[model samples]
Target: MQFENSREFARQLDKEDKLSKYRNEFILPKVNGKDVIYFVGNSLGLQPKTAQRYVDEIMKDWAELAVEGHFYAEKSWWDYHERFSEKLARVVGANPAEVTVMNTLTVNLHLLMVSFYRPSGKRYKIICEEKAFPSDQYMISSQVRFHGYDPKDAIVEIKKRDGENNFRTEDVLAKIEEVGEECALVLIGGVNYYTGQVFDMATITKAGHDAGAFVGWDLAHAAGNIELKLSEWNVDFAAWCSYKYMNSGPGNASGCFINKKYHNKKDIPRFEGWWGHNKERRFLMEPEFQPEPTADAWQISNAPILAMAPYLASLEMFDEVGMPALIEKRNKIVAYLEYVLHEIDKDVESSFEIITPADQDKRGTQLSVFLHGEGKELFRYLMDQGVITDWREPNVIRLAPAPFYCSFEDMYEFGQILKEGILNKQKV
Candidate 1:
């Protein structure tokens, strides 16, 4: 498909878009009184218009029923987290019983590691991507330290080849094999936050398993932005935050997946609490902990209803539209966005280099561009002109056109704005 950098071309594409109407569902932010081109959904999603109503309903229930709201509300506070099980399972490609909503992303990962990261004497090493999100780095290192292992010796990081920005699948699989018997776990972010590279999760999971290691993914960017088959892939466990592509509010509750084979195992070592105990006899105040026969077994506390309300509101939309439709639009818009960036690069004095993989299968909505011969002023210029993008260190800006709210017009307009910013800076 040939993409043009004209407003009419963009508007025409928008006119033909089947998912265009869904943009109205979000409450977009304004810059200088106009809706900003929101490309930061990779970092923080826009608020769904219905998010307010979701929270309001919970607030009303609490005011009217007090403690009884846990059982009597329309969507009872006690069972509020259960509402996400089915819908979220569909998002991550898992069975309803294999998925559950719980604490924040890193917190959930830590809890899952407590069960999955059992380090025996000789097999205590963990393999992960180099420069994983800082939170993940902290979590893995701390987990190793807690088990009385030195991070330097216990953690193996897969490196990108020299002069390469993204990791290769063969290299990742080879590293897993090299670690072999020493590897106890293979944990990586399904989608790299910095370069927007989508790792080959299924192949990696298989390789990790073959090497006698448990495999898991931190699906922070992958959960809603791309297709995933966690259950079919035979992932041991996984966790994802709802804020980014999921369109839940900032720092909302997280969703988790635990393979069904591990569900009812009495010997599974996990920190238990009343919330994870059998719900049928939860209030009986039994002294012994009886784990639920589902992913809820990992849950340590009762639902955070206020934080979860916005997430449920967003998941309802995902259930309605489904992931196939979302991915369809995502592929088109991201491709068009890449085209626009190149077209603008041809016209401007500045050279733009997209660090993300050109292969559609290896990238998602984000396009991380390295802006050569440009400085922070270009980033400031973009932000000042109603373009909400994420700027990393140096001169790269991460533009993630979330398919739910972004339009082709936004892409074209961004290109024009970018050209003007460059030309204006050259004049100075």
Candidate 2:
């Protein structure tokens, strides 16, 4: 697959792309009256064109039926969250009963930790990647403190080797084995936010279990971007935000997967709410809390229908296309993006180092590049020229060309814009 750095080549590839038509489904943003090349879908996905209609339907129901809309609307408000169970299950590779949509990503992770992160004396340590997303860091440390343990002692972070940007699976496995009897849980982000590295979740999950520990993943960047098999991997629990890569709106509701073996356990520790109670007797307000025999047992409140409406709208698109088709396009587009970056690097005075893994299976839609001899000014130039990418600390720029809306032309054009920005910097 030789990629060329020309508009004609890009357009030809687009002409042959089967998923290119799906780009029209999203409402891309504009810059200077033209569509911007959006590469921040790993941060906030573009709004699906159908999202407005989904919300409008809910708004109409509320206005027309008031409280009765819970039971009477075409998509009833009371059971709205249930709409995601099957669709989300397919997306995350789990049984319908093992998945549910609920609170935001970190909130769901905290709730899930209650049931899975049971830290007993001498076995209270948690293993996670070094420099995880800040929200996860806070969640894990706070959870440890809540149980009267110091984070310094209770949390073990797996560090990347010197001069390396990604964690090796062998190193992570060795750390888990080293922690051994003291490790209570192995929780890591499925796709790293900074480097776009995809961890070997199945092998890590097995190693954690073999060492007598629970394993889980925060799929904030992996949910729709990578293939996940939570049930097949025997993950104890997992959670992910729908906003990133799922094409849901900003800070939308999240999805969760809890293995079936933990479904009906009466002694399982979790914060309960009426929404999690058996649907048959929920309104009856029974004295005892009989949990739903599914992942819904972890629900702490009723569905946030307004927030979830956009998510359901996005899921409809995912259902139509399916993960396999999405992955197929993702691999090609990301490779083209990488190719365009390298080709541009060859011409520019500035050097660009891609920190993401070269293997498609070990990475997703994102390509984090270290722009040597460049700074925020170059990033601003790209943004001003209608390229919407993300910048992390230091000099790394994260470009996630979401396959749904991003095209090969976007990659080629971005390379031109980037090269121009670097060359212009040299003139000054």
Candidate 3:
């Protein structure tokens, strides 16, 4: 599909998009009654129409049932959390019993770390990428320090090649090999938030398993953006939030996956709460803390049913448009964005660098573009102009065009604004 400019290409792609109608299903943010091209779904997705209704039903349940909502409600609110499990499991490619919906991203990360990051006297180290989300860094450091281990000795962060912005798989495996004997776990984000690098999960999991380390993925970025085969890849555990690509609203409830391999094990050890006690006898007021034989054993407390309603709505939308279709749309949209951005003249080469990988297989919907000059100025300009995007530290702007609601035209608009911003900045 050759085209003279990005707008034409976008129009052509939209004309052929099978899920094009899904765009009108979202309540996109508007500027002066016009929908600003939204290219930040990687940070916060556009709201789905069904989301409000979903939450509203729960609100009605809360009003009608009050305290009785737990035991007796229209859908049995006590077990509402279970209503979401099968869909969450299928999305991550894990058995239903191996997955459960739970708390926020960082909370789930900490819970999983408690069960997975058990370091011995000699093998007391954890491996993660350099510049991981600050929360992950803090969690790892605090966990290491709490376990009476030195943070310097207990944490290994893989870096990119001397001047590169991404890590090489070979370099990563070599680092794993070097620390294998002393490594307790390897925790990696399935897709790096800053570089938008979709990692080779199968190979990484294989290497980590061979090294006798527990492997887990923080799929906060990769959850709905990519096709995950966590179980097939033999990934031991995984966690993700629903607010990003899942369109579950801000700070939606999170989900977890524990490989079924550990499901029937009694001594595998987890942080237990009464809500995780065997379902049949949960309300007996007994002192026993017997846990269910599945990932439900990892539940710390009853999930926020109200908070989870929007996620349920979003998951249903996912089921409507299967992952394969969404991935197809996302791949084209991002590639189009990259192509158009790269087409900008080289006169402003010093003004920015696209930190995301050139290959589609290596990225999701988000592209992290580093402004060589003043990143904040460009970011502010785009925001004030009503283009909603996100910014990370130093000087990088992230634009994630989610497949469910974001159109190719949005990408084209973003490209034009970005180029004009660069050109305008150069004049000053």
Candidate 4:
């Protein structure tokens, strides 16, 4: 438990880390004419250094093959999407047949909801966290209205009382019961964007099933940030973006999941396109839709091979290091951050509250700090001083030390910058 400065601590951790070599694979950005601490991996991840090479391969094939690239490339573009399924399936703890890499995040959400949210007369409620991301709220509300139902009454959000910042499992279970027969779908973030709180996906999925409802998750911030078992959890469906902890670059292609149990369930309708048509007869130019019996059936159009190559390389990195080791270092790094944040004077604690859960098991790699007096001002100060992080509207500063590249030393060094920014300088 004894460590010196952030540098010493990081060196010690690096020496013991089996996955330390993985950092060499990504491109890290510098700030303020100096190398800055990047704790915002929960927002946008650093690019994989190999990403350019991966894309260049496809570019070379495209340049040489032209129209023939579909079947003639080094890796056939027609079946290139298939390459990622096996590795991506492993990251989410799903069978290879149940995962597919496709579409941007919100687009996938709407598509998955089309199949999951089959609202009827009296059963049209959607259960989600009260502070769910704005995009999700829009999607849910719009979906409810699309079904001739008012979102005001149909969308049920779970919340905690005043003076409380975290939601309890029992409370969520109780709410699901209270809304039982009426609830049609349950959607929650695997790890909430603002709070960095990891919800109990398996438990929530069970509760949703007991109530005869579909369960889905938005793993934008959680996908590669934590270990997930969506298939084993029996989650009806799930979707995630890869730009964050996956180091796939900004606006990279996303991934989706459809339980193996529902792969052949034609009754669960999906928005159809030729890409999703049955693989055996994909190029036959048939009018009838023949969906594949796995998550591939959910695909709409051809995925951008170049955009997805980064994810391919990143997922391979995950397989190389494994999740347990990353999670082990992640917990220690985050705990150090919490310890450093708490070491600040009580007066500062009274002003800047750590909204993210403190328990190692309840959260992942990030912490959301809520500033009372002047959050924006402090944010600007930190930015000017080369301390990089993200800000959520109203008052939260989110800092996430990504496990792949972030070290404990970076966390401790930033802690010093935070103290100076908040305590030594005051413009408000």
Q: Candidate 4: misplaced stretches above 4 Å?
A: 2-7, 346-351, 426-428
Residue range with the least summed lDDT across 10 consecutive positions in model 1: 265-274
- Candidate 2's TM-score: 0.99
Which is the leading candidate under lDDT? 1
**Candidate no. 3 TM-score:** 0.95
List runs of model 2 lying over 4 Å from the truth. none
Q: How many residue pairs collide in each prediction?
A: 0, 0, 1, 0
Tens-place lDDT per residue, model 4, 308-382, is 888887787888777788888888878877877776535353466898887888899999988777657788878
Q: How many clashing pairs in candidate 1?
A: 0
On residues 36-111, what C-alpha lDDT tens digit does candidate 3 reach at each position? 7787777778888988888887788789889887877776777888887788777888788888998999899989
> Which parts of model 3 are misplaced by more than 4 Å?
346-352
TM-score of each: 0.99, 0.99, 0.95, 0.95
Tens-digit lDDT track of model 1 for 257-330: 99999999879899888899999999999999899999998888999999999999989999999999999999
